[model samples]
Structure formats: structure tokens, C-alpha cells
Target: MYKNKYEPALDIYRRTLDNQLKLIHGDHRDIAASLSGISWALGYIGHTEEALEYSMQSLAIQQRCTPSYHPMLAHTLRAI
Candidate 1:
């Protein structure tokens, strides 16, 4: 939803993301992916503090779920 109109999409995205996250178990990859998407949308809309926070969360999850040298870890780090 970050494609067409950024701010509005983020508002919509935020409203649903948390509830979805609650249904996810542990530190799943899908949780990290959702966090990354939210972070990207927040960053794109100039909410840098929130963006950074979510990105950091994503990074932490990726770190725990993947190997140190994993490609996804590198990607999540770059995202932050």
C-alpha cells in the first residue's frame, strides 16, 4: 500500500498490522517481513523515528531466525 499514496496507505497499514502480528507465533519470518514493510512505508512517508524502530525490530528478528551470514540478515541490515 505504499505505492499509490504513502500517508493514507500507512494509516491503513498500521491499523491492521498489529492485530495480524498478534496472530503470528514467536519470531517468524513473516513477522520480520511485516515489520520491514511497515518500516519502509513509515520511512517513505517521513516518519523516520518510527521507521527506524520497526526496522530495528525487523533486524533483531532476522538475526535470531537466520544464520549470521544469511542473505536475509544482510538485506534486513541494509534496510535499517
Candidate 2:
């Protein structure tokens, strides 16, 4: 039941990430946010390894694009 709920969400998050990657040329906050969303969905679906990977990717982007004290960086770190 839980898996059923998260699976569709996971698919949507993946599609969003893909679209963001296509539309945006470089590392951007929106892409990082999308990656974070995908990470959250993957974590909820028990795909912890994949979730961690996405989370780390998000963190890296956030670090590069955002200030050191940015809230998004903290959020991504927490997710990691």
C-alpha cells in the first residue's frame, strides 16, 4: 500500500528532474530542488541508496550555486 502511493510520486519526480535537466543548461536551484524532491520520494519508497545519491547530487549543486549559509544547503545536508 505504501509502495503503491510512493511509486507514482517517484515517477513524477523522475520526470520533473529529467525535464529540468533538459530545459536548464547548468546547475540551478530549481534543478537542485527537483533532485531533492526525487530524493525524498525515493527515500519514502525504501530506495535509500538511490535516495542518498540524489540527495548528494542536490547538495553538490546547492553548494556550487547557493551561498554557504543558504537554507537549501542545510535542507540538502539534512536529507543526506
Candidate 3:
């Protein structure tokens, strides 16, 4: 099933996000990247609301930490 295929990926993304949060004190590109990973996994798993939330969070972090023209920001925007 689609859920079975993506569930493991979602779990990994969540764990990675947790680790990134613990290691990084504030908004960082790594954190944003983790969030984006989670968002992608969640979206594939059919958790659209949560996916959008994570995508927004990632976008916010990217906007704050990276240049406005950063590829990551553009990616997050497209994801949202």
C-alpha cells in the first residue's frame, strides 16, 4: 500500500527532525531541510494538513536564515 511504503520514510524524517531540533538551538538551514524532508514524507503518506504545516515551518526558517534567492526557499515555496 502507499501508506506502508512511505510510513518508514515519515518515521525517519520525524526522528531526523527531532535530532536536528535537539542539536541546533535555533532556526538553521539543517533544521529547515529536515522539516522539508518531513513535509515531503508526510505529503506522500497523505497527511496533507501536517505536510503543509511542516512546509510552512521550513519556509519560515529558510526565509529567516537563508538569502531570499536561496534554492531551499524556492523549493519550500513550491512544496507549499
Stretches > 4 Å off in candidate 2: 1-4
- Scored by CA lDDT, what does every candidate get? 0.80, 0.89, 0.89
What are the clash counts of all predictions, listed in order? 0, 0, 0
Top TM-score model: 3
User: By TM-score, is 1 or 3 better?
Assistant: 3
lDDT of 2 at 70: 98
Q: Write the per-residue lDDT of candidate 2 for residues 1-80, one digit (tens) a residue.
A: 55457778888888998888889999899999989988998898799999999999999899899999999999888777
Runs of candidate 3 with Cα error greater than 4 angstroms are 1-4
A best-first ranking of the candidates according to their TM-score comes to 3, 2, 1
Query: Which model, 1 or 2, shows the larger lDDT?
Result: 2
TM-score of every candidate relative to the true structure: 0.77, 0.89, 0.91
Which residue pairs in model 1 clash with each other? none
Error of 3 at 46 (Å): 1.0
Question: What does candidate 1's lDDT look like per residue over 1-80, in tens digits?
Answer: 33568777666667656866778768877777778888878888788999999889889988889889988778878877
Please provide, for model 3 over 1-80, each residue's C-alpha lDDT reduced to its tens digit, 9 standing for 90 to 100: 55466778888888988888888898899999989998998898789999999999999899999999999899889888
